[model samples]
Target: MTAEFHVFTCLSDNIGVLMRDTTTGACASIDAPEEGPILAALEETGWQLTDILVTHKHLDHVAGVAPLKERFGARVVAPAREAEFVPQADLLVNEGDRVMVGTLASDVIFTPGHTAGHIVFHFDGAKALFAGDTLFALGCGRLLEGTPADMWHSLQKLAALPDDTLVFCGHEYTLSNARFALAADPDNQALKLRAAVVEGQRADGQLTIPSRLQDEKATNPFLRADRPELARSVKLDGRDPVAVFAALREWKNSF
Candidate 1:
């Protein structure tokens, strides 16, 4: 029962991840940011595309859905709310839905706010999470289609996942994310130390992503909505968790 997940960068900074069952050669694409890199990855691994799991309706995330679906004749599975924006779907699922690929079964987590229909695919047994734009490495997606309250609740859902979950998000925004992270939580020793390490990675032109959920809980301001230090920095009038989250997100956007 050997199962492995392969992750690759596609387009400019988007991610295309494939979870595979080694014995069955079955695979599923987390997002369709681009066709070339994903096609190449599939070719190299000799895995059959079983399903296309779309998190949201962002162009960078679903632009290649049409071509990829045409080529592989794979079924499109997306959040029920964004089914209209995504390419034709064979299944429209919401939170708590389960998607299977060979021996792997993933729980569909609805984590909106980045987009009205954003969702995450969590393989509980594998300790992996394909969290599109909802949750990033050391940051989170901007509040585009949802409000601060919406995003705050959405982030809390991801935070509740197991600490060891290996988060695979949509874009490669860790470096810039770390910059804002530093400004928002300068006293956080973990973030301060990681900022330097992230700088070194960027200096070498390397990608800094797939951060552990545990690390994000410690550093990501969005996920730390309850931290008293962050609450002070944001200066929320009340002890409202949502207010703290909103303030932190606003500060990060300007940062």
Candidate 2:
């Protein structure tokens, strides 16, 4: 049976999602930005929380974890490298590890950049990815605790996923990200069109998440760093893809 996902917003910009398997009653929480929304989502869906999947050790991501776990006696699955900070973590996963959400198995993909030990959960069967802060719709997270090179490689790992994958990231930053994308890639018709669409979506008080990986691959500057056109747009022609990616990240920080 297919998995059902409820993607919601919290903490001004953070995102929280709930996943439930239809065939079985297995349910999981993907990053708890806050408790109220998560609890509300659970009650609305009538899906008992069975597990908490953490992408990193960030406060916004784990703050509501304790409350939810107490309520449901859920298992908290977190990255091993940052286990000390994750409260009541029951399972510590690393790259290539398999984590089960009921009978469905999600692969652990280490995507450290936003944090030194950040990770993403990829459920190939569900055709969905819980990317947390490693990537965004039209942009990516800042290099808070990692080098540009580290983030670039991490993004490459995520980019390799199938184009049809639906990316459930951790925020509603697409409007601003689209503006920066235009500045960096003014000549991209697909990006320009996407920016307009994003503006309208935000203006109407809508969320632009669960972005397709195909769209990101075609337009996101970080993901398009290897393209010669993108390199020229950033005035970094002939540079390594990682360097171009670094320039884009720096440019975005101040954008």
Candidate 3:
């Protein structure tokens, strides 16, 4: 049986995701952004909450972990590097570790940029990535606790994933990310088309999470930092891609 997913909004713009293995009826929440929405989704899908997989120590992502665990006796799986922050974690994982939600297994990849210990869960069999704040639809996470180089390297790991992979990020920042993308790569036809689509989607009160990695590779400015066009866009045509990435990140900070 295939893995199933349910995406919903929680706590303003935060995106809450629930994954389940159909064969064994095992369910896991990507991050417990809020308790009510998670409980509502569980009730809607009738999937038992068995696990809480945490990507980072951000409060918005983990605020509901304790409460939900208290309610369901769910196991909390979190990053080992930030174990102190997630005191409820039952399993602490690092890079290359595999976490199993019933029969579905996800490879743990440490993507430390948004936070020093941030990680993304990649379910290779399902071709899905649960990228907390490491990456977004048209943008990436702000370098709050890591350097631009750290973020750039972290993005590279994500960019190398299979094109067909589906990316479920942590927030609903696609429209704004699209606007910034268009400004950074004004001549990108693909980005222009995507921006228009995002605008229409938002205008119709739609959610734009779970974007395809293929589309993101083709249009996301942050992922295209190594390209010459992005280099020139930042007026650093001959600089290294890391430098280009740094410039783009700085511009995006205030965009």
Best by lDDT: 3
Q: Which ten residues in a row have the lowest lDDT in candidate 1?
A: 229-238
lDDT of 3 by residue, 1-255 (tens): 489999999999999999999999999999998899999999999999999999999999999999999999999999999999999999999999999999899999999889999999999888899999999999999998999899999999999999999999999999999999998999999999999999999999999989999999999999999999999999999898889999998999998
Off by over 4 Å in 2: none
Per-model RMSD to reference: 1.5, 0.9, 0.7
Q: Write the per-residue lDDT of candidate 1 for residues 169-223, one digit (tens) a residue.
A: 9988899999988887889999998889889988997777678999999988888
Candidate 2 TM-score, C-alpha based: 0.98
Top-scoring candidate (TM-score): 3
lDDT of each: 0.86, 0.91, 0.95
Write candidate 2's Cα lDDT for 1-255 as tens digits.
589898888999987888888878799999888899998998888889999999999899999989988988999999999999895899999999999898777999998889999999999999899999999998998888999889999999999999999999998899999999898888999999889999999999888988999999988988999888889988989999999999899888877
Better of 2 and 3 by lDDT: 3
Q: Which sequence of candidate numbers ranks them by TM-score, best first?
A: 3, 2, 1
